[model samples]
Target: MQARAAQDLKARMTDALVEAGLTYAGAVAHHTPRRLVLSVQGLLDQSPTLREERKGPRVDAPEKAVEGFLRGAGIDRSQLQERDDKKGRVYFAVIEHPGRPAAEIIAETLENVVRNFPWPKSMRWGAGSLKWVRPLHSILCILTADSGEAQVVPLDIDGIKAGDTTYGHRFMAPDGFAVTSYDDYTAKMRRARVMLDADERAGHIWQEAQNIAFSQGLEVVEDKGLLAEVAGLVEWPVTLMGEIDEEFLDLPPEVLQTSMKEHQKFFSVRNVQNGDSAGGIVRFITVANIETPDHGATILAGNQKVLSARLADAKFFWENDLRIVRDKGLTGMAEGLSDVTFHRKLGSQADRVARITALAREIAPMVGAKPDLAAEAAQICKADLQSEMVGEFPELQGVMGRYYAQAAGHDDGVPEACEMHYKPLGPGDTVPTEPVSVAVALADKIDTLTGFWAIDEKPTGSKDPYALRRAALGVIRLVLANGLRVELASTLVRPYHQNIRAALERHGAIPAEELNLPELSFDKVGLVERYQESKEGGTEDVPAVDDLLAFFHDRLKVHLRDEGIRHDVIDACLAMDGNDDLTLLVKRAEALAEFLKTDDGENLLQGFKRANNILTQAEEKDGVEYSFGADVKFAEVEEERALFDALKAADGAIKPAMEAEDFAAAMAAMAALRPAVDAFFEAVQVNAENPVVRRNRLNLLGQIRGICLAVADLTRVEG
Candidate 1:
């Protein structure tokens, strides 16, 4: 919030200055915990005077129009100049704008900025109408001249006048200090026991903490976010290391780190030799704003007392959750999930888990995982949601699940899968490499996408309340990164049909056993037909799986485009069959993208487009499709006969290469025809005077179109 507020201040001030017709070379904002400072360099003393020519209506235009133009230009008819336009004579008005002094504009802009600053939360105190993030103490507004003279900008806001004075270190140095410029101000702030830059403060805190920990043969567990927050909380930082109670050292390292950081703003210290193997978080470091007479010994005593109470509560939750996991396995702990609703349209969390389990089992063989293990892992991945430990710290959901699964003595992969399945949460995050984890992860994301898509609750524009876009991207990443060949067209149908059936059953719109529905195809038309056969309702109830598949294609385009593959290349590949297999689709797109960069591939594309255009136009004009039967006997030119032989040889190679999914080889074979096709078009005319020759030439173009389209829809490839 502080950083954003500082940025907003800079932007708003710059806009105001520009509006006042003043120009500055550059501006910068400095954000600290208690202050936002803005400095503009190379500021102009005053704006330049402006002279503008305003065009008005023609001389013959309506009287009312001419009068309105004159009034808008703020000029009389005597001052207007007449010019001969192409249409008729026109009027032009010369207007001049006077500039204002910089000091006057700066005073007004500063007052306005202070009065209307944007804050996430603000408070009013002492019967003052002015609201601020906290009680306003003082304002520092100074203009330093090039001659090293400092002058305060004249302004008053809510009875507080602007000045060039600032105080620092509320406890250590409460006296106010005045400075001439930014450099002097920062130097004096340091002497006053304050740090002016947030980044510098963070760096200092981290280095001192690390040095203290290393001196004791320990290392600080680094958390950048916590370091930043602690830096913001102090101006003069004094790092102190303290011991943790041995009673709580047996807890998990993550739990200890999370507890200390979240509750106390403390950095965990780990033993260098032990690491995080068993119990490594034996000490913690805290930052204070002032130096103490006794070197923070009394402060550590007080903080340790408070920290012990917080850890006692954490210990209680951990012991209670473990006792339940010991009494009943993780599955038994998850039995209550049936009462927890996943969504209003969707069923309970238990219902979602069931769908994921089934999908995981179905996807197991394709991803090279055992069906039983994948199913078992998916069944209990969310069991930790019901544990007491997770209730207090929700971010520890999957972390606790892994521990509980291990305690339950599940398989090696199952325990790991419990935690790893939620991974790749972002583009920077890692995806699971274990087979069981991969199967469960894919199943989880696919079910989310299809289920929401089934209920007509798809994401619209930027409002993805259900994160459907992330789920789709997750599926794409999982497939492409793992080189998996599971076809999404079929994989998405079963879960979608299940969601539709569940919704219908909940509404009593269809009887469960009476439906006896067949497997719905990936296309929406097939789903509509299946629904019509079962009931009289319209297609509105049918899930648009084809549209969902298109959504996946859109996300895949974005994903591949980030890797330097063009969107048009992806669109060309999407036009082909088996685009549902993202791995195959991306491989073909990558090969085609590489191919388009070459001279042969570029010439081939042009030739294919030329042939396709001629064939399309001939078919439209003649009202007949000439798709085949291009006889070499009617070629009439040597280039035409060579193209015929080249087409045959290319077809033999491309067919097998395409079958083997060697897209590079297929593209290479297609590129070999570029010279032949270009020569034929260059030497022969398709619309010949002889009727049979013209028909044969058109048929030859059709062959070119067919062969190129077989590799990929080159017609969709853009220049």
Candidate 2:
């Protein structure tokens, strides 16, 4: 945020300079929490004079038009110049602007930038019109020349004036000092016990903390985000390490770490040799902005007291939650979820959990997981949402679930699945590889997507209130990363039907049976009947399942775009049969993506396009498709006969290869036809004078289109 403030200053300053007809080479900034310092480099002393010519009405045009031109130009008719033109003659006016001094321009620019600065939050004080993130303290603006002469730019806003003096380290160096240049200002700031660079302050804090921890056998858990934030909060950092009280040491390491990091802004320290299982979190490192005579002994004492109190609360929550889990198990605790509304339109959290449980069992066999295990894992995965520990730290929802599951004596991947099912919370997060975890994870995300889509709550233009996009991407990653061959068109149907049925039952004025809605079931055979029937009837009662599938396709394109696979290539694969199978779709896209990079594939694309163009035009003209009856005996040239033989061979190889989902082999077969197709187009005229010969060549071109499309829709592939 400090860096963004500096950038905002630079951009506004640059715009002001442009408005004043002045220019600067560049800008440099050093931002601290309390101050933003920017230096404009290589600025012109004054703006250049501008000369412009303005065109006017024809000389012989209406008198009113001529008068209006002169009035708009702020010039007299005598100042106009007559110029010869094709349409007789025209009038022109010359306009010139005088230059303004750089000092004058800088003053106006700085004042405007300060007055209109964009802050995430700002306040006004002392009945002043000026608003700032903090109180307006001082302004230091100076222009240094090559000869070592410096002059302060004239600026004043709301009783604050620009000067060459600046104060540092509010408490330590309360006195103001003068500076002549940027280098001199920074050097003096260092002497005042102020660090001008945030990165330098962070580096100092980390290195000192590590050195202190290394003297013992402990290491600080690295959190760059916390480091940067702590760095921004201090102008001069002093590192101090403290030991946690022994009473709270036996608590979960995450509980200890989260308590310290969240409440005290301290970094957790753990024994490097013993790890979490043995040593646990024994210490914490804190950064203070000032050094006392006792070397932070007084500061550490106060912080330790506050930390112990916070950890005491955490310990109570943890013990209380564990006791509840031991007495009732996760299921008994999850009974409260029925009271928690997941969404007003789509029933409660318990209803959603039911849909996910059924979906997980249905998807278990496909992902190599036992139906009972997957269903059980899904049933209790979200049970900890009601726990006191999770209520205190919302980020530890799944993490706490894992611990409670273990306490409940659930095994066979159930304990791990409680935590791992929410795996891949982001793009950089790891994907779960366990079969039971994959089934539950896929079920969780699919239910979320289908539920929102059923309620007509689809994301629109930078607004996804439901996080549906992230859920869709999660589904895509789970399917592709696990190599799960899920036909999503059918997998999505059962949950979508359930989501619709549940929503209707909750809020519908009419019963579902009155509207001809079928009962929601997990029957594997013809599972898509409910979803498909609604779509085929073109009713607004339920959203199209294909629309949700297409959303997954959209996310897949974004997911593969970083792998250098083009959108059109994924579109080509998407246009083919069985596009609902994300694994197969990506495999074909990857193969075709690699093929299009090779010489054979590139040339084959051109040949296929050429044949398709000719065949389409002929079909349009003849009012019939030339898809069959291309007899080898009717070939009028050797090139035509050779092309027919190549198509036949490619078809023979590609059919079986595509059936086996061996996309590489199918693409290779398609590449073999490039040479024959190219040679035939070169030797034989597709639009021959003889009708029978022309029809035969058109049918042969149709053969090229058919065989090439068998691998992927070449028409969707762009050059």
Candidate 2 on 1-719: residue-level lDDT in tens? Answer: 89789889988998889778878888887788778988887888899999889999998899999999999999897899999978779999998888988888899888989999999999999878999999989999988886778899988888899999999888888799999988889999988889978889999999999999889978888889899999988889999999899999888888998889899999988887755434578899999988789999999999999999999999999999889988999999899999999987777899778878887887788899999999999999999999999999998889999999999999999888899888778777889989999989988898888777666689899999888888888888898998988888765654465546655654673365544454445444233555666556554454356788778888889999977899999899999999998999999999999999999999999988888888888788889999888888889889988988898899999999999999999999999998898899789888889888888888888888888888899899997
Leading candidate by TM-score: 2
Q: What is the C-alpha lDDT of each candidate?
A: 0.85, 0.86
* Best-matching candidate per lDDT: 2
RMSD (Å) of each candidate, 1 decimal: 4.6, 3.0
TM values, all candidates: 0.89, 0.93
In candidate 2, how many Å is residue 641 off?
2.2
Report the CA-based lDDT of candidate 1 relative to the real structure: 0.85
User: lDDT score of model 2?
Assistant: 0.86
